[model samples]
Structure formats: structure tokens, C-alpha cells
Target chain A: MLPVRRSILGLMDRLMSFHRGSLWVGVVLVVIAPLSVALLLSMWRSPFPINEMISLLEDAESSTPGRFFDPTIRSWYRPLFHLTLWGFWNGSGSLLGGLHWFRYLEVGSVLVLLLLFVSYLRPRTGLQAAAALLAVAVMMGMPGFRDNLEIPVLMTLVGMPMALLVWMLLEREHRWWYTPLILALTMTAIGYKEQGLVIAPVVVGAWWMGSPGARRTTTAVVVLAVLAYLAMRFSTRGHWALFEQDVGFLFGELGEDEAAARFGERPWILYGYSALATIGNILFSEPSRGTFVITDHALSGETRPWEWISIVSSTLMTALIAWWGVAILRRDWSADAWSAESRLFVILVLALGASGALGFNYARDRLGGMAVPFYAAASYFAVLSVAERAGAASLKRRATVALVLVMLAGAWQLRAVGTLHDVRLRAASTHRTWITSPNWSRVTFAHRPRYLSIMQTMTPQGTDPARARRPTYPEWFLALIGGG
Target chain B: MPAGNTRILAWLIAMPALLCAVGLPLYESSDVAQPPAMADTFVEALDDRNVEHAYLFIRQGQDPNTLVRFRDDVRTGGREVQVSPLMLAVAGSDDNTAAMLLSFGARMDYPPNRYVVCLAREMGMDGFVDSQMSTASEVECPPPSGAEFPLLAYVD
Candidate 1:
């Protein structure tokens, strides 16, 4: 009877602690939402779909030629949550079930992050921090912390919880097992996608930023982890020469031969422009760069003016993020205490993580033009933070007012549901249009047969230099009719 | 509010008028903004040959990647076949209704088995990638060493 009573008391304490933590998170989630949503509205696509990258893993189960790449350690490194998605898919007899499972996980993870952020915020102006978060959200939309491609069910249930567990070490003393958990998470993130490389450095940096006494030891662990990762990567894939096939990177193969084989001996600038033409693919036009700018095959000509904009923006944006991060970290406010330093660190970390998009220079050709989202998010965060600090007026209120105005002006651009419906309605009309209209080129870009034939054949593989350039119906075709 | 600031602002304002005379045309043309287009025939000609260059022209919203998969259709006994007419489009303001047709002209010896189309319209972008499968025996190719069917004939 006494043991039971004691257990109940302990449970109550933990519950109360958890409740306190969650309240802060809830408020911040509200704060951050407006910003995230605004960003989403402006963005080419909702930046939250790291799920697509995760979906790659689940899809691999079915891809046969792809099977050649999968190995034992690779399987082990995959997040348990991503792995679980396959199971859920099998159980529910539909991939959508697994997808929903992930959505719920994402929603739950947001809540958990809110709790943690709030807990961190608590040492400061408690409710004010919540208001700040709300301001942040309203200003930025949900920052791009989550991947659009990762399998969410296992990710939420296993991956994120594990991440949070490691996060606890940032605030409290490290449990002996925490190292393994962090290593495990990093490895899993990598297995989920190659972009996981971006994560490893941030974490190692985070670990080093902690307590002075532990800094050296943590740094050593980070170094060893990185070394071990390299060793594994080399052992498995290093022996195999990096294939110079102009496959996915429309950025052009930075292959030894091609780099040297340039006619002008400088393809970088040219590739930069070509990458810009491919740039809009990341935002407005397609769901992903995956299918359209299929591979290195997508790019053309020299870097264009707009592409230069992409590069400059991405650079300034990255610099801004790095600045915020350095400023925050330098202040010794590593954890979420109320100190200006702590606030700086929190915003810095958020900015850096969000700015560091999972999809880096997507194709070799496109650094500036192709890499827009990361910078956009970063820029959005910087603007939001500046706005919040600038005055007493709530950013949320302003952004909401702005959003309504924008929607009123261009309701068509803001809604996702409309996009989905447009596709359905136009698809049939397009078919009819194509059947009825003999001149294929006369039809809209959607009706082109070249696009149709490839739909089932294979997804986009970017341009290969060796392959002769394929025929493309020009963009001027738009002007062929009225309103183009 | 400062006197120096006001003078600097006046100078800045004067500079813009000088620039606007030059900037107006560019600004006006840009407002009719669209990604620069390739000569219509260059894109169209490639589509006719079912050549590799044709595939490179796929626009936004179109699946230029899936348009010509190399490893796809190995099972169900299809020989290595190259499908043609890479469809890549830009989903316009009403992405569904505004959805424009753009293609990379790599002539496919075979017709498409399926397509996923996104339409541009007032509401938004929506469409289906209609998937269909056809017999593999119809294609003629020397079988790839590892399999019964020929590997996909890469248009390139």
C-alpha cells in the first residue's frame, strides 16, 4: 500500500513538471504558426514536407535496381520511426495510413517542441516568451525544422522523442546512454537521406557549446563520431568511384573530366544561370525538384540574372543566420534561460536549423537559384525577429492583417486545396484539349505529349552531358496563343 | 530628421529619375514576367527526334524525372523501352487551369503508359498522374545481362 502511494506521488510530480513544460510549448507554437503560415503562403511549396525525403526510404523497399544501394548498416541507421512506416503501410493496406500516422506524429512533435521551448522560455518572462513565440510564428510561419520527406509515424513515435531525449542533455546532465542515442539519431537521419550530413555538424557544435568542463570531451566524441561515419562511408561507397553520370544533379557533373573538359574552361558561371532556369521548379511549379529538373539534364545555358539573385539571397540569408547563431552562442545563453544571451541562442539555433534546408544546393548547377527556400525561411526569421524587437505592436496582429490583405488580393495563390482541384479538373480537360487539338505545341504546357510519355517511363533524371540534349518545346509557346 | 539626412535623401531621389528613364522598359517588360523561353522550334524539333535534348526542356510542375525512368518496368516482363515526349509544365496562377504544356522532345519509340497531370485553374493546382501498364513483349531489345527484359533504352 505504501509503495503504491509513493508511486502515485512520483507520478504526480512528473505530470506537473510535464504540464508546466507543455504550457510554454503551446504558446510558442501559436506564436510561430503565423510566421510559418505566412512563409508557406509566400513559398513555392510548404517547407514542412521533409516527409518526402523519408518517403524515399519507404519507396526504396519496392525499387529493385535501387536495392543494390541498400546494405546492413544502412538499414540499421534508418530511424525506427521511418522503419515503422513500412509496417503501418503493410498493416493498414494503404500508404496513406502510414502518411496520416506521420501527420499525427508531426502535430504531436510540434506540441512536444512547444513544451520544450516553453520550458526553456520559462526562466525568462514566462508568458512574454510565449508571446514572443507567437510573434515569431505569426511573422514567419512554421520554420523549416521538420523534413517534408521523412516517414512521420516512426519519426514522431521514435525519431523525434529520441531527439527530444538528446535535447534534455542540453539542459540537464547527460545520461551515459545519451551519447549512443544521439549517435543513433544522427545515423538514422543520414539513412533517411544524404542531407543528414547537414545535421551532424550542428549537433556536434551544440555538444561543444555546452558546459566548459565537458566541452573538450564532447568535441572529441563529435570528432570520433564524424570519423566513424567517414570510415563507414568510405569503406562501403568510397571504393566505388563516384559515378560521373549526369543523373540527378542538373548543376552539371563536377566530375574531374567534365570540370576539365570545359570549352571556356569556366562552366561555373554558366551552370549558375542554367541552375536559375531550374530554380522556380523548387517553389511555384512543382511539388519537388525530384521529377522536373530530373537530374543534371535539367539545366541549360549560363547562370541567368534571376539565378544570381537566388545565390546572393541564399548567401546573405546564410550569413544572417550564421550571425544570429554566433551572436546567440557567444552570449553563453546556451539553454533557454531568460537572459538576453539565452534568447539570442534559442532564436539563433532556430534560425540556423530552419535556414539550413535539408535540400542543399540541390543540383550542382544551382547554388543561388535552386537553393531559395532555406534563405527565404532565414530571411523571414530575421525580419520577424527584427520586427518583434523593434516595437510593442504585436507582429502576429500585423502579419494576420497582411495575410488577409494578400489573400484578398490573390486568393488563388494562397490556397492548397484549390491547387489540388485545379489539377483534377484540368487533367481531363487537358486530355480532351489534346485529343481535340491536333497541334501538340499549340496546347498548354500541361498537354504536351513529351511530358505525358515520361510520366510512367521513369521519373526525371537530370541532363547528362554525354547524351545529346533532348527537344524542348520553347517557353515562347505561351505567346503562341492569347494571354501568354 | 537630420539636415544631412534630408539632403542625402534629396540627392537619392534625383538619381532615381535619371535611372527610371532607363528602368521603365525593363520594369515594364519584367512585370510581364516569365522565365525566358527557348525558341519554339528548338524545343519542338527535339521532341520530334525523341532525342535526349528533348527531355531537358521539361518545365515546372511536370515530372521530367518520371517521364523517362531507366530502371522502371523491369518486372511484368517489359523489355528495355524508351518512352518519349517528356512533359514538363509550369502551373500558372490558377495552376490547374493556367497549367501550360511544355515538353522535352526526346522522341519515344513507345507511347506513354500513364501520366500524372497537374492543371492550372482559378481555385488552384490539381490533377492526377494517371498510371497505366502495358505489355513488355511488344518492345524489341537485346535483354540486359541481369534480367529477362531489356533495360530501359535511355533516350540519351
Candidate 2:
């Protein structure tokens, strides 16, 4: 019995030592697994309009920078996103091909984010391998990633990695070119989405949390880039803050008047609920779940009991993770335990808060960039805590706990895999129904005809009409329409 | 890992959940006006040139004369109509009773394109119906005038 116990302890120590060897393998698995799932799911035809591609192509073809900022023509000033899309569309020569390129880009962004995270954790001891893998899995499994595959959402996703890269770069060497490069990246990120402005605050926050240096350098760079962004935005959109124009759509018929009324009736209370709900949606909701409902009446009878169970369980887990994050922040700040990981947690928390404040409703896609830091912090602390406890425990007890955690992680991975498979099945069915439908007049269950009408108006006549059609109508649609 | 730390962690987690639980119901139940799904359907149908389908979605019980006027106004218009679902939802108060002031796009003959669609519940009816239509700038149902039946609105 004594010999057996000694051997097991020796084996556990050996396994711990071997984690370095497994790091690359773990990184590859973490990056590839979700991307493979995404690729498989991509086989289904998208019902969403290729409005972004069409708009970019038109902008490029017309050679009009005016339209880029024109409030009536374009809703927002995202020049970098427009240019990137233009390049993709020009290169691909087809809308579908451009969309496929976006999927690849999205996967690549996820890889970059994972690589950055893994590189940060590689130097840390103990269960960081487990934590890194778990973080990646959690991030990939999020509904936000799935929702962000759509064109508009993909634009925001592009900005996320750019912002993260800027943050990473800022923490390291400060060459003369670094400021210009950081400024350029920051501006480009903003051009992708207004949410990119959150990067400025994140950089500033990170600098504040960072070791004391010429703070003025970081501050000046961020402020200058922001001013430049504002100048460009104002020049193009005729306003410094154009997000309000977009928010008007959320008010429905009442527009700003409804917002005013809601504000009058306890502004803080309304916003507070919005923030909490947004966080909840970010952490708890799965990609395979049905649309989020704000009102009690909107709850569907079809929602399974386990769906409710999953929500509650996820909520509890999220709360615990968040609590742990708060503890880490408190401990680290007080102890002056300033590391890249700690600074990242600070950035994510701020970003999450900023995201909640900017948007009125809970949209999983909007939370995509913010969620990365959250999962990272949660996983890091979880592993650290487990490692700490395991180090102090008996070998038999350590093995039992480690085995249980592995089993839980396995279950999570399997659940994510199962959800993706389910999504693929649904997407395939929806795609088939979308293509086979004869009457374009009536809205099918799988497709919204309203969007199709909008797309027809947006696409230039020179572009193939079939490409603009929903479910991207195959050649059969042209035949059915007598090549109209 | 100490008992004190565990208690502090518990409090930290509990506080947010507690606040959310207390605040969410209050926020949702607050009186904010929003248009019903039926209004969205009606406007969409009108946009699609399916006036009959639009009319079908309107809950019945309006002054016969008023109904005729609305039907004629929608059918004869060369003017474009765009229905924003968010606008419809935001314009009306809770309790299925609400009014929407719609803007009509310029036509060859018409200079101003503004109409009001008022929805209210009839006595003992389960659902709210489109009770009135007017070209008047201001129309209110279940308010100071109290001429229209009050019905519970659907919250989306």
C-alpha cells in the first residue's frame, strides 16, 4: 500500500513537470477545436443579407469618401472596416466568397486572442494549462462568437483582436514607433466599431495599473488618437457622437420620446437592470438557446425545463467566477502584484462595464470582445485556487479533486460539441427550406422577406441579383424566375 | 480559504444577484409605452401592399365611418409608409392600449403625411383592438377623454 501511494505521488509530480511539453499541443487543440466546429457549421447557407459587402463594394467602385461619413448614406464612420471589406470583396469577386473570407478572419481573430492568452499563461506554474484550455473552450462555446459571424457583428469582432493586440503591445517595449503604431491600431479599431473606443480607456486603465513610467506618453497617445478619431468622425458623420442615431431604432415608433419618458421614471434603475441583464446574457446564454426575452410574456412555452436549469446553473457559476475575479483584483492591487494577467482582468472588467453602459439591451454579440478577459480571469483564478488547495492536500485527495475537475471540463467540452452539432442540423434544415421555397412574397419560417427587400434596394444593378437574394438563391432561382 | 473570506465572497456574489432580483421586476413593470406586435404586422403588411392583410391584424371595433376612412386612406396612397417596430413598441404604454402617430412619405398631391392609429380593448374583450383612426394630430385612448376601452398591452 505504501509503495503504491509513493508511485502515484511520483507519477503526479511527473505529469505536472510534463505540462511544458504539452503546452503547444494544448494550444493547438484549444484553437482548432472550436474553429473546426465553426467550419462545419459554415456549410449551411446564411439567410442574412450581404449588405456590408455590397455597401463596401459600392463605396470602393464610386470612389466617394463622402458617402463613407454621410449620415444619410452610412450609419457610422467605420472606414477601416469598409476598406477591409472592399479589399475582400474585390479580391473574392463574389459576395459568398467574401463572407467565407470573413469566417476565416473571425477564426483567425479567435486564434490570435487564444495565442496571446496562452503565451501570457505559459510562464505561470501548475494548472495554467488546464485554465488556458478551459478559457478557450468557454469563449468558443459562447453565443457571442456564433452571433458575431454575421457581417455587421464580424466587423466588431475584427476590432476586438486589434484592441487586444494594442493592449498587449502597450505593456511591452516603448520604442519611438510604438506610439504611432499604437495610435494607428487604435484609430483602425475605432473605424471598425465605436466599441473600439473602449480600447482607449482600457489602455489608460492598464497604464494606471502598470508600473509607474512616463504616464504622459501613454496618455498623450490615447488622447491624440481619440481626438483624431473624433475629428474624422465629425468630418464624415457631422457629429461627434452618432451612436444616438442608431439607438433611435430601438425606441420603435416613439423614438427619443420614449427614451425620455423611460429616463424620467428613475433613470438609474432602468440602466442598472440593463447592465445586470447584459452581464447575465454574456455569461449564461448558450449559442443554441432561443432568443433572449426581456418581458415575462415573451417567454416561450417550448423552453425545456433543462434550459431553465442550465440558465440557473450558468448564472451561479458566473457569479462565483465574478466573485473570484473581484477577490483577485483586490488581493493583487493591494499586494502590488502587477502582472500582464492582472492588468488584463482590469481591462476586461472596465470593458464589460463600458459595454453594458453603451447599449440599452442585452445582446450576446456586443459582449464578444469583453467576454475574453472575463473567461481568462475566471479560468486563471479557478486553476490557481485549485492548485493552491491541491498543493496543501494529501496525494490521494489531490488526485481525486484533479480527476473531478478534468471530468467536469470533459463534460463541458462534450456539451459544447453537442450544441455545435445541434446548430449545424438546424442550419442545414433552414438552408434547405430557404432555397426550395417558390414564393418570395410570403416570409418563410426560415427567412425574413423584409431583409430581402432591403438587400435588393442596397445592391447595385450591375451586381448579380441572384447573389443578393436570400439563401443566396442558387442558379435554380434564376431558372424559376425565367432569368429575370 | 478562511471562514471570514468565504463569508465575504458569499456576500459579494449574493449582493449583485439580490439587487438584480429586486430591481428587474420594478424596471420591467414600470409604465413605459410601446406598440404591440399586431401594429408591427399591420404596418409591415401595408408596406408590402397587402392592405387586406394589414386590416386583418387590426383588432376589430372601430367607428364604422372611421374604419372606412382609414381603409381608403391606406389603399389610395401613392405615399410610402415605413413601420418601425421599435417605434411602435416605444410609442405605447403598457396595458395593450396605445396610440401611434404615423408619418406618411410625400406623395405628388399630399404635402403632410401624418395619421394616428389608436388601439384599445373593447369591453370584455381578451385582446386589444384598433378602436379608432384619425388624421387629427393628437389622439388618445383610455386617458383623460376615456372614450376608448382600456385593454392590457402585450409587452415584448
Candidate 3:
């Protein structure tokens, strides 16, 4: 054979190899492709300390362990999330420095999540080496992935998905310490984000599907764990700071009295609306910009060019994913009552439900982070299933079509990442401009003067032109930005 | 035991699962208020010059970097110009609106902002231009295209 053909075959041999060492190497190879793209497109720069201001202030107010559980200090209780911040704060000595550490951890977690997911899929789904890499790339390329990676405080957004994959993997292992292990996992997830409560249902699903031996004790533990969590959660101040004045914010111009009057008796209506809208935002490419929701965008009948592109690409991708899912269920129905395909389908549905329901307070793109992985896994299975059933002649044709859809979705996701990167860069720029302006002192302090002063002191003094314009990654990395 | 029973079990758990999902946020949302109905479409309350609304909106969650067009009535030369809130604030000479937006991280790097810089120079709002330029000496504007843009129709 020619040299090029020989090299190609050799690489394929290595990729298809199941050697213990190479398996890990293959997983790393798979992770790097998507992680590199994500890093280049979204997280190549340090972010402004705007979003993490409250957490930093809370930490400053009390360097005590008790503050983590003090729900009155913030809208909700998130100890593990704050603890991670506290670790960074003490280690890095400034909010911006801590955020840089967070940026690194965010990417590191993504790498770990992908590694665990790829390892899990290898045995269960039997995806080819190349297909596994592609699936991970497409999953990480989802629009919500950008939001998950860029927002430092929203580390739990990424963590919850990791927890979901962990639960799925753990269910397969009927170890002796399963009860405590699962209980610990559940608590850790809840401590990450309020939405981590979704993991409880996941635990229940696992108990139902997995071994019957541990059911009684597992059920007792899960129930006790959930009850304990709720007891602690409800005993708190019962306030979302976004709508309260104590945190120095109000939902738009609506005061607490006005908000209470509006959503008073039937807050469920608002919650339900937000939940549905959040789900719609995930599945369909509905605009979620500024104060605008999909309804407003629809009524206005005005969409930016990129918004239209997102809508078309996302709607088509959703339709394709749904079609592929139905095809898998139909094909696998005769195999078993609960085949691997069916179980995964069930997981996908549950995850989507959890993602939407998590938005009961309000809908944001990051809320849908948990669902994207399952969506990507389902797509992987669907593609493999189709290719598996096709005759040799038709295989190439089907693969090409699937590849095209993946490419389109990938491009759309990159656009979303680019937009996020632009927003962050602008945020950094505007922050520097604001601090340096003569009118900086005259700026209103909606939160607290102390918090603002803390922020001002923490902000890097004097703008470096390079930092203002764009982050200075290595020259080779800079070259990847345009290609990304 | 049976497949059908498992399906039943799934349904049984779903109700509590939902309650688990919605219960916590709702319990905490006892004092929470809904966003304004027009909050979605109206990107900014600059048309009404409602500085308080803008202040709260930015403080709460609205991205100040979002570029919104000025209302049609603010048409120049009988046409609507797609202007950033910063530019419109400068145009109407609302220092409070400009200052509030700027402090909250409104961007001046958008392509349209260069036009705003020129407009600021033309209007002799030198102070506004000076604040935007951190290290620059003077405002620069491209020659006008003399194009007439149409008015944006009011959305119902």
C-alpha cells in the first residue's frame, strides 16, 4: 500500500485497539478536539468580575463556614458552589484571579465529563472510536455548552450534567457501599445548584432500573436525603434575590409589592410559563435576548440575521434528533422491554423534563445544560443504529447526510459561542471604561456601596490595551481562533 | 416485576418528581415578582426616559451590552437610525441615562458606536465622547452616507 494509506490504516488500528493504556489515550484524544474548540471560541480570555460580585461580597462579609448555609445571605443556598469560590478566593487573593482559576476548572471539568461519558458509551452503546469522538464534539458544540463554560459562578450548570452521567454510570455498579455513595452524590449535586435536586429523580430511576437487592435501603436513603435537603431549604429566608431589594436588584422596575401583587395567589402560572418557555428555548431556537422572550420576539416579528440562523438550524436539529430517537425505539422494541436504547431514551426524556422544570424560577440558556449531553448521546446512538442497519452501498450516503447535519449544528453552536465571547469581551471593556471614567463615583450602587467599593478595589487598575481588546493567548492558539 | 408494572411505577414517581422540581423554587419565590409584560420586547425603557426602570433592569439581569434601537419618534432627518442606547441617550442629551448605562457596562465597541462617536462630535457632546475613549485624544467620524432609513413600525 502507499505511505498515506498505510498511515491511515495504522492510526485506525490504534483507535480501534482496546488496550487499557490506549483506551484512555483515545478518550483524551476525543476530549481535546471539542475542548480545544470550546476554549478557543469561548473561554480563551479571563472574564469580568461582574457575575461573581455577590459571591465575593458574601465571602468577604463572613469568612465563616456558617455563611455557606446562611440562605438569607443570598437568594438560595449553594454551599459547594460557594466553597469552590471560597477555595479560589483564598488561593488566588482576588475575584479576577479566582475567576481565572475557575476558567481553568471549568474546562477541566468539561474534559472529565467527556472522558466519563465516552467511557460509559463504549461498553453500553458500542460506538466506533471515530463516532464517539464526533458525538462528544457535537454535544460540546451545543449552544448551552457555551453558557455553561463561560459563566464562572454557574460551574454547577456543568457539574449537574456531570452528576447525571455519574448517576447513570453508578447505577450499573452494584457495589456494597452503593447507598452511601449515591446519597453523597445527591447531596453534592444539590449543593452545586438548586437544580441539582433533579438528581433525586435520577436516583429513583436508577433504583427502578438497576438491581432489586438494594432497593429498600436505597429508597430509604434517597427519601431521607431529599427530606433533609427540603427541610434545610425551606427553613431559609425563602427569597430569590433578583426580585428583592436587599440584594440591590428588582425584576425590571417592579418592586417587591408590585411583584407580589402580580404573581401573588397563583405564582404557579408564572412558574409554569417560565418552565414551558425554558423547554421551548432549549428544543426550539426561540430568542432569549435582553428582556425579550420568544413571545415578544414572535409578536415583534423582528429577528437578527443570526437569530434567524439559530432558529432554523436548531429547529431542524431538533426535528432530526426526534426522528432519530423514534427510529431507535421502533427498531429496538422487539429486542427487549427495556433495552439499552429504551433506557437511554427514557433518560433523555427525564433529563429534558428536569431541565425545563429547573427553570421554574426563570428560563435561561444555562438551565438547559443538563439535557444537552443526553441529547448528544441519543444522536450518537441513532446515527450508529442507522448505519448499522444500512447495506454497505447505502452506508456512505447516510453517513454523509448525518455528517452534514452535525456540521450545521456545530457551526451554529460556534456562532453562539462567538456571541458569548463578544459579550464577555465587551463586558470587560465597559468595566474598565466605567472605572476609569470621571463619572465613575457618580454611578448608582443598586447592590451596596460596600459591595461596589469591594468590586472597584478588586478590579485591575488601569486598562491594558491588549486585555481590553482581546486576551493574549499563545500565537499558535490565536491562529486557532479564526478556524474555530 | 412485569414490564407493564414498571411503566406504572414510572408514572407514579413522576408526580412527586415534578413536585420535587417545582416545589423548592416556588417555596422560595414567595416574595419573588414577575418581570414586566413588556420587559421582553422593549429591550430598554429609554423611550419613556424611565431611568429607574433602566437602573433596576440592568441591576437585576438585563445585559447592558444588548443594542436596542431608539423609538421611531426620535427619528433624525425624518428616518429612524438603529442606535445603541448609549448613542440615543447622547442624542437626547440625557446624561443620567448615559451615565447609568455606561456604569452598568454598556458597550461602545459595536460598529454603530463609531457612528455615535461622530454624532457626539457633531452635537458637541465632547464630554460623552471623552468618557468613551479611554486613551484616545479626539472623536473621529466617517463621512456621512446621506442615506435615509425608514421608521420602525410600532410592535403590537
Each prediction's DockQ against the real complex: 0.03, 0.02, 0.03
- Model 2 chain B scores worst on lDDT over the 10 consecutive residues at B100-109
Please, what are the lDDT tens digits per residue for candidate 1 over residues A1-484? 9999999999998998777666645644553443233222222111112223333533534444334344433423343444545555565665445444545555454445434443544512232432333322221111122223122222322233333334445345655665566666555645544434433554554554553222445546656776787677666653332223232333333443543355235545434433433333333222123233222222554433323332333333345445655654555444543433343344334323322242222332221111222323333334334333333435576445334322221221112112222222322333333222222322322454443332222112112221111112234421221011
Indicate the residue-level lDDT of A258 in model 2: 59
Candidate that beats the other on DockQ, 2 or 3, i.e. the better one: 3
Q: Tell me the tens digit of each residue's lDDT in model 2 across A1-484.
A: 9999999999998887667546544643544443343433342333333444344455565555445544445545566666666566567986556655755675676556656655555533323444555555455445455455443356667766676667667777666666677777677777777767767777778678762331568668888779776676566554332113212222122234454465646655544545554555566753221234322222535544334433543554466466666767787888877765566666667776766664443233454454554454465555456545655677687666555545434434433333343444334433323222212212221154444443454333212222222222235322221112
Q: Candidates' lDDT values, in order?
A: 0.34, 0.46, 0.55
lDDT of 3 by residue, A365-441 (tens): 66677777777677666545543443233546645654554454344434433444444455454444433342444
Clashes (backbone N, CA, C under 3 Å), per candidate, total: 125, 15, 2
Give the Cα-based TM-score of candidate 1 against the true structure.
Answer: 0.40
Candidate 1: stretches off by over 4 Å: A1-25, A30-86, A91-131, A134-168, A212-225, A238-484, B1-156
Indicate the residue-level lDDT of B108 in model 3. Answer: 61
Off by over 4 Å in 3: A1-17, A20-44, A51-55, A91-100, A123-130, A211-216, A235-265, A287-305, A327-336, A390-453, A468-484, B1-156
